[model samples]
Target: MAGSTLDESVTAFLKNHASNDAFEETDPVKASQKLFPEIAYTDTEKAELSQWLITASHVGSNTEDAAKAAERLSTLNTHLSSRTTLLGAKPSVADIALYQHLASVVSKWSAEERTGEQGYHHIVRHIDFVQNSPLFGLKLDEKVHIDADNVVFKIKPIDAKAEKERKKKEKEAAAAGAVASGATPTTLTGDQGAEGKKSKKDKVKDKAQAAGDAVASTVVGKPGAPEGAPTKKKEKKEKQPKPQKAAPVEKPLSPSLIDLRVGHILKATTHPNADSLYVSTIACGDPPGTDNTSEFEGQVVRTVCSGLNGLIPLEEMQNRKIVTVCNLKPVTMRGVKSCAMVLAASPRVAEGEDSHKGPVELVNPPADSKAGDRVYFEGWEGEPEGVLNPKKKVWETIQPGFTTTDALEVGFDVEAVPQLSGEGAEKKTGVGKLKTAAGLCSVSTLKGATVR
Candidate 1:
């Protein structure tokens, strides 16, 4: 029969509660609820479980009430297990039927130990006794018969020897099949045999090969091509130009002490009192290091004073480490104060793939630019000029053009200026400096000056 038809008997048991005289019939839930109402439901539970009753009334067709019936039956089973007295001094078939109602009705929590094996074992014990009993309509043998008195009785004989022989034959047949196919035999049942395993292995290999081809294409420019093989079509070679003089070999630049460690923003929330201000907590440190822990101490907590406001979502900043100016003075915004400024890329295109344009491009790496690192300009050897704001702990500009507004407008104009390194005739425009006139610019860093 279909699974729904099998549940008809269980559904009829729950429907008895809606009748005027429920106790006149053998009602499983009513009996269990009266025997143990405290265990039936809790004080926190609502008394108006009529919706559930209506749902259980038409359960076979009602999808919504099907879930409720299953839950109620499962709870009844738990109560039956904990309180042994409900089954009386000798466990009766009625108790077993009550427990089965829970297992068959409640479909949720199917995998849970309390409702699965434990519940099954207890019900099976009662089924065994009822099957052995000679009581009319009580005994469960194999074929159920109703006598002239309209009484039910069953006759089922245990067949241990036949069950064992059938299982043994199944095992041997599986082993012989494995040998004939030249595959390793496994006693594990279901879809865990060599044929199933081989299919899974082939699937995994195909997936891996596809992934490798994709990676190879990214590096070599074509699928199945050797690594580093150029993908683009080559153009005809042109004659090379020679220089009059050769430049000196450049020295390798050293890593900045401060930039060695990285900091990530942990949380960001707008400042309660300030409209333009944001309160941010950041964590900095080298990922786990040597036993000393001080190397990681380069990791420190710092706050960011950002104008991003609504431009960048707070969640976007989490775990991101942009450059942070650690040695700056704290400034008060509205009423709350900010510790340092966060270094970020200039406003460019946003992130994502739905744009009419292709993938969003990253800002090009400057000819000699390293982000998050301090830049020091070439200067005469002497004390640098600048007033240090103790409250701010930052060096204020003494030279002609160095203000917040000037810094903000630095990228607008580009102009040529005399080389600061004393290269007599050669003139190069400061690549990343504020151009004040047709041929003048100021750099992010001062020439040999210390701030903070």
Candidate 2:
């Protein structure tokens, strides 16, 4: 790098930006905004980029605490697990900082460290994405070659709805604990005065106990009974339930909440009762004893029922690497419990058109992608729900944005999804291609088709 033919101005520009991490408010969205003025970043995004930039910049600090650095890396990994870029689908100066600082260290990570039980899988994923995605276009002399088969630990997909509820309960419990201890109010669950008062459950329990004590006192002290007479029995009081709280707001609709995976079809058979459905044994990267999964030909696989029996040939459906929606609630079709849905691309049907036609093609994963590999729409990447509610129609809501580019590559069009279009340039536009860590998801011959 020292002997390169770069001019003095170029060298100075690089040096100044490298030193900008030293600036807190360069922990400054203004600097990042100056770097890329086209992206109209919100205050939240600016703050995020600022903090992560500080973290990324200080990743190799000699004075930083060892545990703190490790924690920051883990947090970064978790953050990237559901995002394509640091700013959640948009590239930023912070991503560059992360790549510049940790690429060397990530390159040397063992398979266990890269994807083990407590591994930084998302960091490895970020490194790979940063170096390879056209968004960043970093030109390194040597790029880290990530092996798809070397992932030692398979992290189960997160359930967004469940996680939200868990957090909500934790918040309420903390508030309750604070109240119980007579601490100053911190979290606001509802009305401030009401929260200050004894919780309904606590008040009810205290009243019940007091009444029970009074009854027991009188029953044991009755003088009408003989001296040796047995005491009257104490009646049991039934426990009262706490008042139910209203449901939390629904999670925002996004492609990231749908768990997509690269699945290997082990075998395909015609559904016995349903002639239009094909029951398939697919290895979707589930561990042994996963619900609705059975060992088929020595592989733990899910039994998926797809209506491709008449649309696609039996041979095409057999032994193929296709994308599967892994989180939808398993449904029984024609006496067979279908565990997952196979994604396929078909021509867009007009209002009066027949939905099930012969021109359907399986959405293809990269040639090197393995079963259980995380698949996501590029910009809309994030953790998916553990089990998507069929009743809620999450898929139906997000499916309209699922489409194929002119090149036959599957993607999610952000602008087309009005529900996800927040008030900002960053969220309103972009066609994020569907891909796994390996490469783009595509169909053999289905250009400009609808992918679901």
TM-score of each: 0.24, 0.49
lDDT of each: 0.36, 0.75
| Winning model by TM-score | 2
Give per-residue CA lDDT, model 2, range 55-97, as digits (tens). 7666745567889888877787777755657887555667767
Q: What value does the lDDT take at residue 45 in candidate 1?
A: 28
The global Cα lDDT (0 to 1) of model 2 is 0.75
Model 2 RMSD to the real structure?
13.0
The candidate maximizing lDDT is 2
Clashes of 1: 10
| Residue ranges of candidate 1 with Cα displaced over 4 Å | 1-261, 284-299, 347-452
Query: What TM-score would candidate 1 get against the native?
Result: 0.24
